[model samples]
Target: MFLVLQLAIIVLSFIAHEHEAIAAYVPDYSSLVFPIHKHTDAAKPLYSVEIMTAYVNMQYLHANFLIDVDAPFIWHDCIVQWNIYPGSCPPDKLCTSPVSCDEYQCTDVRTSYSYQKPYCSPPKNESISPGWGYCSCSVNVVDPVTGSCGQAKLNYWDDFTVNVSNGKNVLTGVYGVYPYAACAPSSAFQSFPANVTGVMALSSSPYALPAHLLEPLENVIGLCLPSTLSTSGVLFYGNSPYYLLPQKDVDVRSYLSYTPLIKHPDSFGYFIDVNNIVIKKRSISIPANATTKISTLDPYAILRTDIYNRVIRRFSMVTKRIPPAKPVPPFGLCFSTQSGLRVPDIDFSLPEGKKWTMSAANSIKQVTKDVACLALVDGGATSEPAIVIGSFQMEDNFLVFDLENSTFGFSSSLLRKQTSCSNFNFTLVES
Candidate 1:
């Protein structure tokens, strides 16, 4: 009656008739393997040179989200945890012999997973302080093996894989770089008020700079001294050469403004594959110039089979009315059949009296017809869920949507003509 749980589960591995690709629920984004490189300055009109040292060398990538499903012989029992920190432990004091202590002079340790040996080892000390923690995984299919709806759980099908690193380099640099000497020869380098906004390189190392960084105070470089400088970088005055009118304006441009740098891809460039990733059932195909394509039946080909670890997601909380052991997170993946999953183009951007309504049990589900299509032999479409649209924000029992890459498709004749589909299961109402 209230099920919206995707605590965590990813175990990807496809490679034989491969059909699984529609990711970006925010996992495997170590900035997509450290990618953000933009440094512009049509010759320093004001300044733009970002490279705060994010070259994707792993300050983080603890990985683990494996999905392997062929559904002919289901055998799931997932629960994995290893949010370790003892420096990830490996200093060899005999490896500190099973010494785990987090936040109690030990500093953090949590372990889970029982399908016989999923990986767990936390307890050590010698200075371990890194950051970020959330090792919560759960899976339980336990007996349901009857294959043949297109069975193939083992020739390969991976969904989860986690073990990335970089958790401790924290020091990043690059602060706007402004230096046309410091700006204001009336400032012009082509409408260059500065804030060129095309320079990035930040994965995670921000949180230190309260003053004293870039240290140049001799009155801030004498406030860019120019009260008639005689020489020391040219400044002649006389006929045949004189131009001052160019003060495009600057107060640090009101602290900075230049937007258009969505370049976070040192790895997941086309988008996704943090490692053994998973989210199945794809059939993609949407053209007429609206653009969208990705269907070649190679969604990792089930990752070379063996059910890898199982990951189905076409939506089937077991038709239950009481299913919540924990492990739900997926506000996105729904191909078609929960009554044809409706999106109706989703209008009402809001603003003007502000309005949006859809609750009486606001339900929609096309859980999976496996539509991950788009591959006219691979000319376009498959850029990885390039874009989808969604919006929500209702109250008195909440519903909110600020999404990015977008997803939501419903309409199997409007859920066979709604009763709200009699609770097919949807819970985003979060006031």
Candidate 2:
């Protein structure tokens, strides 16, 4: 759930100029070629994959981060838990580097009034007096698990060594070292899933992680979220190609269909042009230019009150014959598995006349052995962005946010294509 203040950024166009502009930044980038050398030649035969990529990987300007996760529905964005280096200096010896209150980065982050604010600050006299006063930069960080926003210190992260995966059953290396992240208080994490250190933000803001995709990488982020928790999903940065093992080395980028990415003058989130919605064969008409945006925070697809009621009501009617099960907490409608019935797929009709269908795997949630519910939620009437496509519906789908081209590309579902987002090599490969 988003604050009403940020929602105003979506509603009132004139008020946008009053705050720091969240422009869709475009960066010029050179083409990167990661060639898995088909052959190493007869004389100096080596690993079929190029050593150039391995050599170039360490010598590159900005390290490319390859993030993977098990549970996607409950977790959103690039989540990380940094392991502080042994010798990085910490002023207070707490192994933390707090940004100065007057630093430019602090000032810029302080202007993020919509999401974060100066929760606690000293008086003007003391804060400005370099000799007698000291104040740490404070900002708000959002917790996805509990949907709570809490005050956090904006600080520089002396990144720790982490594993980088270059496709399944192929390789692993300690390659990435990122800088800067919000440090949430330990109390804030009490409600979080155990061991979740921080959320590596992917929003389009200068202070976020996506801004680092400049030097050797393109302003492109490809995300493949897994459906089940048993396996892992992958994240790609820059111009890197995608290939899942056991299914031949096929780049999944070719399967994506493009849609124009809409720019919101006041927000750091990504928006898209969705014409309407279709359930089964019936079409549900929504306004053409509804404030529709995508989100990693929301647990399920949240529709504006009226729109949600219509969709869920219509769905119930179609399956009225099957007795409804006891009301689930988050889900409105559910039925017993004994009914031996199936749910309808929801189609998001885009402007290009192409519909992105959400199959049962994406639309329905199996809560218990006998209870399966329609995985949808109601965003009280007048919710900004009439439709917020949450992570639940994004599972197993490959999405590319091509910021440079102002386009959004999506692959409906990896399963239907005879693959999975959990392109994980579950079995022991003789690598």
Candidate 3:
């Protein structure tokens, strides 16, 4: 079920009223924090970053900022129906394939292009008509739902600024917004304004540094996503203390754990070294020289059925001491407990003797009052065979992606503590 949810990407947008620039961005000792909220309607424990857009009306949008290591630029949903110019085409005539424009009685308007070109002024002698100029070039937009690609008319917002605040300190950055077909359900769409910035595309966009991270200004950022529904977390720029526990905060610079971030040349997904799995103190044997691949720490933990089977087999072996109940349809291992049962701890052994242990709360799910099912799911036969540590496993942990240093850090979150994260001080140590 989690795997299916990962494939169904639904893009969303929001509208806000326009506002004046607060003040020049100052990098002082003060930190800017944005509250992370959970989408209750989402199938999985999805998180969103609340941001303000500098559209005509000053709209607010929730940007889904994934810890995607491979993304090159930030992406956002723009207003396609507005009928705006996309700038002039390149000298090479590398515009997207031309589409029919009845108003101009011409089919030369390219609807999609390999990359968005810089906005250029129309030639003085050039005649302008509705959808008849070089500015009509299109952009390649991906449908979050079906993973299909289509063309959406392009328009550029020179004053586009996304405002991120934690009620005290606010941070803002500019972004290029592009419109795509609404992928969210109709009911959800009605809740948002008719004209809103649906998405704040970040990570990988054609930029030397990620613009969303206040690129060229502040290169460091940290994310602490809470796993529980009752609590909220913080996403901040620059360095601060390790958010080990909300109630008991620790300086990340003082005692933070470090791991080398493995890079995949062809992808933007963050990958890490995982040696083996240990269930109930017993190390499960993996095939020798099995070409262990780095599993992406994605929002969804998707394990290939083959690997899921191996992990479950070892899990079953350790739990053989308990009475087995009927197995759940989707989940392979499940049990019926009256007084509750003790599920063994599962650990993923990393290099340098470092181990990430999964607590029972993260490894088990209460499907019913009497029946509990394993939270892990099969990736099916065709899914990526590599292991993916999804958001479920990352709950209750402060995940820091230090792009400036090219490293990743993880520590326990301040569980259930609700406080302004801006007040906390963090040490900015460049890796």
Candidate 4:
């Protein structure tokens, strides 16, 4: 039977500081660290943000925000406010008399809610009535993490101005915030903010806000994702070269490889050139002049079925073969666990001698105790024909997005051992 062999490539250059050594180093002050929350049932990581509410006393609301490379601006679920006394509160909460409150009902005239404390004012243009609001309002919506949506009344706030901080760095900007009732209900979760930006919008994103608002020289953003669930990772703003360097004093300038980032006007995703696919040191066949579709490096990996099949076919040829297991619902290929299969080492070669190597663990998925299948899924007819290098392929790697230079950099993750982000010594000073 064909077994998906798990290939483990031991590269000496990939290993770095031991946990004890890393703990001894002092944290850098210029970067903002956002911890990656790896959900048990989800494939992608969720980032957390502190949402400041303008109550009598400033209250901080924490929400799980998605670092979507595909979205242009910040989208969030906001609690509603009113023009009457005591200002605004969630829809389910009782409003003072004479406010004429009903489910999803506000005065016909659009108005901004001003609080007596004057901590933060609602956007002046927020429509008090229907057809005027930037986003729609919802109630009793089902939460994604917890099944109970609860009594959380959610409304939308466009151009919501808030001072977003990563503990050490503060970013003040107008986010395209919206209402999301189901953003982690057990906790007062509120929004999903996309951090990737183009040359024009770089200053608007939180990652580049320091450069735009505070320090002019600070412009780059770095993301280090741990390969395993046991360890946590960080997202940074400003200068964060420490995470990329293999050792404390060694400079990684000579080792770093960069590729141009292809920006799509209609989408916020990052696209790069993928020259060929190498399996077990063998290059797959492609027409010499055939146009190479620019592939996207997304948080989710979805490959064209044809491309996926071609890869699996090449993968099967060089390994011990076996009859495929009975068809699984979503997976095209599956092998019986009893087959004791092994997968080959796969590498995605970019244009400039840059290669992304994948171990068997990154390419295959275990469907059941007795069945394992290829993790690459068919992109389906509706999907783009281009390849999508998802987060699974990016595990254990440090990804740097330099908007100033317009290039993306990849290296082995500094925290390969899966150390928790909380262990880092850092400080978050208010702006």
Over 339-390, each residue of candidate 1 has an lDDT whose tens digit, in order, gives: 3232222111122222222221122321234332110111123433332211
Top model by lDDT, which number?
A: 2
Candidate 2 lDDT score relative to the true structure: 0.60
| Root mean square deviation (Cα) for candidate 4 | 17.8
Q: Judging by lDDT, tell me the better candidate of 1 and 2.
A: 2
TM-score of each candidate structure, all chains considered together = 0.15, 0.72, 0.64, 0.58
Error of 2 at 12 (Å): 54
Candidate 4 residue-wise lDDT, 1-431, digit = tens:
12323222233323434545665665334444455543343333333323332223354333344444543223233334434344364543322211122333322211211111123223222224553334323222222223233323333232222333333343342222222121113233322223311111122233222223334225566655444455455556555543332243432323356777765433434566667789988887533332222221244456666666787788767754755677574666677878676877677777778875666656766778888776676776445635777665565555666767767776533344343233332334434
Stretches of candidate 3 off by over 4 Å are 1-26, 29-31, 55-72, 80-132, 135-137, 143-150, 153-209, 212-218, 242-249, 252-255, 285-300, 322-325, 412-431
* Candidate with better lDDT, 1 vs 3: 3
Runs in model 4 deviating more than 4 A are 1-28, 41-60, 80-87, 90-214, 226-231, 244-256, 285-300, 321-329, 337-341, 412-431
Q: Cα deviation in Å at residue 419, candidate 1?
A: 41
Q: What is the TM-score of candidate 3?
A: 0.64
Quote model 2's TM-score: 0.72
Where is the poorest 10-residue window by lDDT in model 4? 108-117
What 10-residue stretch in candidate 3 is worst by lDDT? 11-20
Query: Candidate 3 overall Cα lDDT vs. reference?
Result: 0.47
